[model samples]
Target: MQAEAGNRSGLTLSVPMDLRQLRYFVAVAEELHFGRAAKRLSITQPPLSFNIRQLEASLGMELLRRTTREVALTEAGKVIYREALKLLALARDAEEQARRAANGEAGAVHIGFVGSSFLTRLASDIRGFAAARPEVEVVLYELSSYEQIDALQRGQIDIGIVHPRVMPSGIASRVMHREAFACLLPETHTLARQEAIDLQQLRHDDFVLFPRDFSPGYYDKILSLCLEAGFTPHIRHKVRNMLTIATLVSHEFGVSLVPASLGKVRLPNLVCRPIAHAANPSDLRGIWRQDEAQPAVLALLECLAASPA
Candidate 1:
């Protein structure tokens, strides 16, 4: 999502109570005595016992076996305690990332992009961003717009460059541009001569498509556009990377529909023609978690906006 300065920072970061409960249970399980563990945690025996019971209830698995004389961990409890420790460590790391993001000191921003997009002027801007913001590490993923959206939802990536579609509820997007569609044809193709090509004329042609996972919305958008022109696109092959797709198109494997920006590819045997009556072409957008407020995200947005294409 594109970030703009809003005076209101309504983000409230919370770790689950089950996590705290797990920690308490682990402390007790490790010591095998509530009194000793309570001493370590600076809490009383009764409360420690209560917290352990609550943890068991939340997890729906018995973690500890306790009696007046002795204490031991149940089989499930032992396994859960090990996993719980890992979860707590991860939770702590996430908290640190959030704090760094708030302070604008250090943080990581994961970015996902479609393959062909990397050849655009935006690619140069990204390199410049990396050089400019050395403290903010940007992890790049070559994914389709659809995969990018899924990654954003799962918190796998902080930002995604994608095409418009049915976005998840808690995700927000900022429209970058409604780029026109370009028809990628082989230099020797019969229809490659004209200044523009009517999409309807390509009805019987074989096509190359981006992987649906990478560009669900955009993928379907292309298909739908062809359908609207009274032809169902004959998808002969699907590839994840646009450059590879273009390379195949250059070899005349099949014609493909791509963003106008793909003209930057400049492959030797590939020619691009504007699509005639191709419905509003794909709109590239930046998407991210609605609850995420990170300076690195804002910084990237600023860089993108300031960049010249």
Candidate 2:
């Protein structure tokens, strides 16, 4: 590329100019005095003068008209000065953008989550994050806890909101919210009218639950809670989706023990009642790979920490 003067002084300056030389030229052009420009640039006047001479030689044009009395810019010098200012400004902007991305203040984060987490304050938390870091884009994926674990392991997602029984190897997690289990029962069921029902009361009822493989830790916790209530549940229906379980219960398929968040579904024929004797609360955790170093991921974690569910 070349910068050519419009008038037929016929000057065409090639674009192999160094940024440092351009900076020096701009300082001199703006100051109109080599000594003052060198002072402003915190450099010795002799080196500045040599660099300017070299820049003029490379451009094959005399950019400055200099005398003992004063300094002035030639037409080509004036044009070059304006272009140099733009180039320097662009370079500074690029540097600042890179730094912001490195600091986690700007970029993109892929977030994986289970659908039930939305029942808590996950939506509000996401909004808060967006408001806090408007430059960082957040993309969300809805996956089961197990799928999230797999995605995290494969580096497909930056972070996950999951219900993990045990922290997987090389993955780190923190519980963001803890919720007690609730019973989703058909409105016509005997215990549906109770504000809170003991699990023992539903021993004879067929249970609709998430498949054990979906989240063994949570599934086992539900079974243990039932055992503590004095009877083993008769699991007759298995599901993978929390909302589907509620839909099934609404149809009188069976009762289900699910995180209290499912109460928000509020299906027509289903009522979610608290478990009277359940002591363990299902944990919703924020998980990430231990080796993650992305600035956007760190920024998201910070946002998650500031907003409590």
Best by the TM-score measure: 2
Pick by lDDT: which candidate is best?
2
Weakest 10 consecutive residues, lDDT, candidate 2? Answer: 1-10
In model 2, what are the clashing residue pairs, if there are any? none
Q: Against the true structure, what is each candidate's TM-score?
A: 0.61, 0.87
For model 1, how does the per-residue alpha-carbon lDDT over 86-127 read when each residue is reduced to its tens digit?
777778998987786675547777899866667566678778
Clashing pairs in 1: 1-287, 1-288, 144-214, 145-214
User: What value does the lDDT take at residue 35 in candidate 2?
Assistant: 92
Q: In model 1, how large is the Cα lDDT of residue 158?
A: 88
Model 2 over residues 1-309: C-alpha lDDT tens digits? 233333346555555767899899999999999999999999999999999999998887789999999999998888888888877888899899999899887988899998888888876887778778789898899998888888999988999998867876999988887888888999999988998998889889999988888988878988899888889999999988888889999999999999998888977988999988678888889999999899889877877767755
